[model samples]
Target: MAATKTRTIEQLVAEYAEPIADAVGLDVDDDDRTLSGFTRLLSDAADMLSPADCTREWLEDAAEALTALGYVDTDTARQAILARVDGLLYEAKSDLESC
Candidate 1:
């Protein structure tokens, strides 16, 4: 059996950040301050999700971070974040299943 590889916060952030920025038509330079903030948000989110334990606090923190980052402050954006996290969870689950 293969060993499961857990993604680090940095890795996941790097993987998703550009696509998200592009999707929103934001010119997020790699060295930009906003990018750094986004990285922090992503890191925090990843930490909250590290153990695959979803707590209300984690969810709330994530929503706040997204709002602060201007991702969106509506129900739709919250749902989108949940869906994106779900995709990440699916990836993690696949890794575990393969192991």
Candidate 2:
């Protein structure tokens, strides 16, 4: 059988950075501040949002993390980012299951 690759949370964050930023209405240009902020928020969410830890409260925590990161705090932005977060969490869960 082929070996399974387990991705770290940081790796997952890096993989999903662009989508996460877009979802949060961040403009990641030449400067890295926006990306960095998104990274922090994603990293924070990743820490608590393991497959087994996935829940509505965790989802709310992700929204709160986005707000704390000083991104575009709006209903649309929150919904968009939460969708991305859901994907990220699902991938993380799948990764764990495969392992």
Per-candidate TM equals 0.33, 0.33
Clash totals for all candidate models: 0, 0
Model 2 misplaced regions, further than 4 Å: 1-69
Residue range 1-99, candidate 2, lDDT tens digits? 975344333454555555444444444443333435545555544454445654424434544554543565675654555555556555544443444
Assess each prediction's global lDDT (C-alpha) against the native: 0.46, 0.48
The lDDT, on a scale of 0 to 1, for candidate 2 is 0.48
Task: Tell me the lDDT of model 1 at 27.
Answer: 50
Reference-based TM-score, model 2: 0.33
Which 10-residue window in model 1 sums to the lowest lDDT?
54-63
| Cα RMSD for predicted model 1 | 13.8
Total backbone clashes of candidate 1, pairs 3 or more residues apart or in separate chains = 0
| Clashes by residue pair, model 1 | none
